[model samples]
Target chain A: MEFDKGLIGGSTVLLILSLLEETDRYGYEIIRELESRSDRAFQLKEGTLYPILHKLENDGYVESYKAKGERGRDRKYYKITRNGKRQLAKEKEQWEKFSMSVNKVIGGELYATD
Target chain B: MPLTKVDKFLEDVLSHIKFPFVKDDISFELESHILEKIDYYMEQGYDSEKAEELSIRDMGDAKEIGILLNKQHNPFLGWLLKITNGMMIFFIILNIYFAGIPFISSLFSKNPINTIPKEDIVYKIDINDDKIKKIQITLNNGETFTETEFYEDLFLFAWEVDNEEQGRYFNNIKGYDSNNNVIFQDEY
Candidate 1:
């Protein structure tokens, strides 16, 4: 099923941070990995992904460095910072709480009592 | 390989990025992304021409990407430039206000100021109440002239007047005795 763009947009930072926590990835690698991991459901457009990456880099949550690719051209890679790790942990906690509450509502168990 | 299509694509994308210092790195990154996507397509057995076409198409609109990149590279510059322009306009208006008011007032105030000339004025007047001292007096506006060589009562002082007092001004006159008692007074 296709997800709402808003949902994907909100989760994008979290997903990017989580991916970078394991190993550094360049821009195209991140896009492909996200697609593969989500079974090709999270098809982030090139225009959308780059601006967020630049914003994350500018904000100090991620940093990038250039390394030559197999084709002898520069590939920019991004890695999460210590600050990004903390931000990820906080986001994870908030996501767990939010999802649990959302599940209760979806399951029809949550209702207004008063 | 001629990069004609890629060059056109990049030109379109970079058109949105206003700052020159930021252009090269952003252009490189995006171009590299396209080339990598092309390589992926080629690994799937597509020819170079088709791969380049597909990669550029997959990257979506250049104008859209340019807007995003432009925002990232030079944040707030457009707004700051506008604010700076507005302030310059305000300062120009203020300069005009400071420079124009005196000139406008001079243009509107047309009446020439009247002045008393030193040679045409009665520079000194000495009047005494002595019984035998003769005195000449003039009224600023009256046609009658009065000259007094008086004995008493007014002290019935004989007086003379003349036309030369036309533009001169006087508002008060008084007489006092040896005891400093006010004996006479008049005002016009």
Candidate 2:
């Protein structure tokens, strides 16, 4: 199922930070990883990703550098910073609380026991 | 060469960006993404044109993307940086012109005192007669000193000279009797 743009937009930074936390990834690699991991459910607009990435860089949440990609082409790779890791943890906690509240309101059984 | 569909798409997107420095990187990254997507589609047996079309479509609206990127690359910040860089270069050149030239020239030139030729001697003073009624001192550089009653008996003469060029002055002194006959002459 395709996710709503508004919903994806709100958590875009969180998703990117989580991805970078695993390892450094370039623009295309990040997009491909997000699509494959979500089983094609999260189809991010290719053009919009850069602005967010650049914003994250500007905010000191991530740092970028140029390196050779698998195709021998120089690519701009982004690495998560310590600040981004802290932000991710905070966002993850918020997400858990938010999803739990959402699930409770929807009468979902996943977090019903808690 | 005619612009390709990909190049046209890039131009459309980049045109909205106000910051020129980041445009090349943005263009390179976006083009690489599109090319990678096209490769993915071609692997699935799609023609090159069809793959390119799909890749461009997946990038979403070019104008919208450009506007978003422009927001991140704030033109004010770019201009500020450009102006600051230009000011820095201007200051460096000004400093070289004002400070560096004299220092470099000094290294190659002779000692400042030696640079003044002997012919440019300014002041030559000579005092031999203790009983003098009149005296006149003249310098080659168009400076003259005259004293009628400089002192009661000592004939004291005092004058200030530039210390940096002191070596060029006080070369000789000639004393004359009341009859204007040379009585004493000495070279310093």
The model with the greatest TM-score is 2
The digit string of per-residue lDDT tens for model 1 on B1-188 reads 78799999999988988877667888788888888999999999999999999988888888888888788877476457667999999988887788777677656443222133344443234445463233333456543333343322232322232445454454345555555555665665
What is model 2's interface RMSD? 0.8
Model 1 segments more than 4 A misplaced: A108-114, B75-188
TM-score of 2: 0.66
Candidates' DockQ values? 0.44, 0.55
What TM-score does each of the candidates earn? 0.59, 0.66
Look at candidate 1 and tell me the lDDT of residue B34: 88
Flag regions of model 2 displaced more than 4 Å.
A112-114, B1-3, B85-188
Per-residue lDDT of candidate 2, residues B8-118 (tens digit): 899999999999999999999899888888989999999898999998999989999999999988999989989999999999999899898888866755443344555
